[model samples]
Target: MKRTEAEQFTRRLTHHGEGPVWLGHHGLAVLDMLAGDVVLIDDSGAETRREHLGAVVAALRPRRDGGFVAGLERGFCLLNDRFTVTETVTCWTSPDVRMNEGACDPQGRFWCGSMAYDLTPGAGALWHLDPTGAAVQAIAGIGCSNGLAWTRDGTRGYYVDSLTGRVDILELRPDGAIANRRPFVDVTGEGFPDGIAVDQADGVWLAMFGSGLLLHFDRTGRRDAEIAVPVRQVTACTFAGPDYSELYITTSRYGLTDPEAAAGAVFRARPDVGGFAPYAFSG
Candidate 1:
């Protein structure tokens, strides 16, 4: 099949918009990392400034009660329709930790990982938040945790450890616990794995940050396809649109020069693969 042209979906924002997730028919939720804000963008590409969330807002996942949970550098916050921080969960006992990427499981548990802002090794950990807002550390001893997704069957979880250049898959038990950790994919050379999404066929879509590319992988950890993007820092992606065929990607210009400002834009394309039904909060 002929590859489709990548379409520019959204213009550049003053601060970089990193993490993006689909919120059903509502719109796309984006995190303005540098300005510490959360903005909701509708299908018309108009950004509705929601609230000022301190630190960098890295990722967002919809909640059960019509609100959403946003992952910030220091911790996480809960936002309602009015976009206020109604609840907050601090991830670190020390002051050096910062949260990165996050997603929800089929059972409505919010899973997020944290790392040192400076990319220090062994300075990150993953945590799981139950429906009741109680948080627990699920895994530790990691570097730069980002991009998390689960298999369609809900028996496995996939995640990216960006600094280590590896994606790991874990066996998830019935009680929302994970085990049998192993490397699922290793990205070599330039780019680091940033965000991930699992399709209906159990294929994993990975955004290679700083490389301007999106990668597709089958369940057995084999590269199925790759799509290139104009933006160098492809931060994250999610399946949107009515049929979930539209793949919307978020990019950043955090370390780029002035000439690269336009590089911090969102892009979209429709691949041959279809996405799975996004996990919803059931609390």
Candidate 2:
């Protein structure tokens, strides 16, 4: 497939912008991971407001309760309508570890992985927290756990451990857990893969940071298409347009110089195929 170029959608800058998600009327919400902020942006790309959690807001999803389930610096949080921390559950105690990218399964169980601030190899692991509040270790020995997306039918899951240089797939057991881990596709990019999304056709669109591209992988794990952006730090991507044909990408200006004007802006693109609407956290 030919490489598609993206256009700037919004001009909001993020030190480490990540985790873009669409919640219909909610417009778009993204994490300024290092800034410990979750900012809401309208369709016009205006920053509506931001919630400062005093801790890194790594990833989050809308909850059936009308709030959100989120991964924070040292634990998971349940926020109410006012964006107040109604509940906070600590996973591990060390400040060295921080939450990374995460997404909810069809059953409403939220899964997010963690990594060391120093990026210590094998110092991170993926964790699953169900609505019942039972947290389990899904995968161990990971470095820089970055992205997680599930298939439409919820039988399979995809993950990116940026350090591994490949996207991995796991069989989602009936219990809303994962197993049988294996490599899905190997990738060569400038800064490894970041966040990812699955289309209605199960096509995987991955953000390749430092490479200024979003690479597309088909169900068979073959590189089929790619998108070129203006900046090197393409952090994450999601589908949120009218018919879900518009792909929204999040980027960062962290450690960047002579950067493209749109480096920290949200970029928009139209793919031939639309995407699957993500399920909210039913918990």
Candidate 3:
């Protein structure tokens, strides 16, 4: 039953800020999802950089080789040192579906999920892109594929298919493949779970879109606390800041009617535990 409030960290910088990641030495990066923009915000919150990638850019993460791997509209792409895309791989030819949210596993493979732009049921799926540039469909018939994260030990994973109204737990095999899947938490009556972050303690911090709350579930999946963000369309979150003690949240102005000034802004709050830096894409 613990509760806390998040403070605004930036102005209304994105129309639909979806994925937020902390790139250790590179600062914070969040995607303006439907706008195809990759935004970089300095630590001081005094500077911001926007780079347009395509018609839509869903998610992004740093690369181990000094660049980045991003989920573009239909597939994925590799960015160079300057953050310019050097290669693109299209996994599907469907103009109706697009990549959504994702994260890198401990083994350095990037996993992103997709959803039909029209929100058609069972038209989306989860995809995994290994370090060798090959891709595979990990889960099919996904309604709204979103939020993916792994535990510090890489033994477990948390995945969200918004349409299911639940977060599913995953058992990761030694080769990084999924061994099993089951329900971890059912959020049917609450708002949709958009994004999540797993702390070093294996706790899951989830952003409940439209609920304006970031829920904290302990290792056993019991709800322990809720962090309130000022904006209602809270989309995603990640642990950042110096010691990874700060939780950074992204909000969306996508469907709001005359949304408030902070609707599309990013927010931050310090939680009780710390989180590990996002895994870098090895490919």
Most TM-score-accurate candidate: 3
Residue-level lDDT of model 3, residues 137-163, one tens digit each, is 988999999989999988889999999
Each prediction's number of clashing residue pairs: 0, 0, 0
Model 3 segments more than 4 A misplaced: none
How are the candidates ranked when ordered by lDDT, highest leading?
A: 3, 2, 1
User: lDDT for every model?
Assistant: 0.79, 0.86, 0.90
Over 4 Å off, model 2: none
lDDT of 1: 0.79
Candidate 1 lDDT over residue span 1-283, tens digit each: 2334567887875356677777866688777776787777888777765568886776777877788787777677788866777888877666677888888898888888888867889999988778777888888987988889887778788889888788888787777778578999998785888998788888888899888888888889888787788878888888877778888888887767653655766788888877765675544
Q: How many residue pairs of model 3 clash at the backbone?
A: 0
Error of 3 at 149 (Å): 0.5
Superior by lDDT: candidate 1 or candidate 3: 3
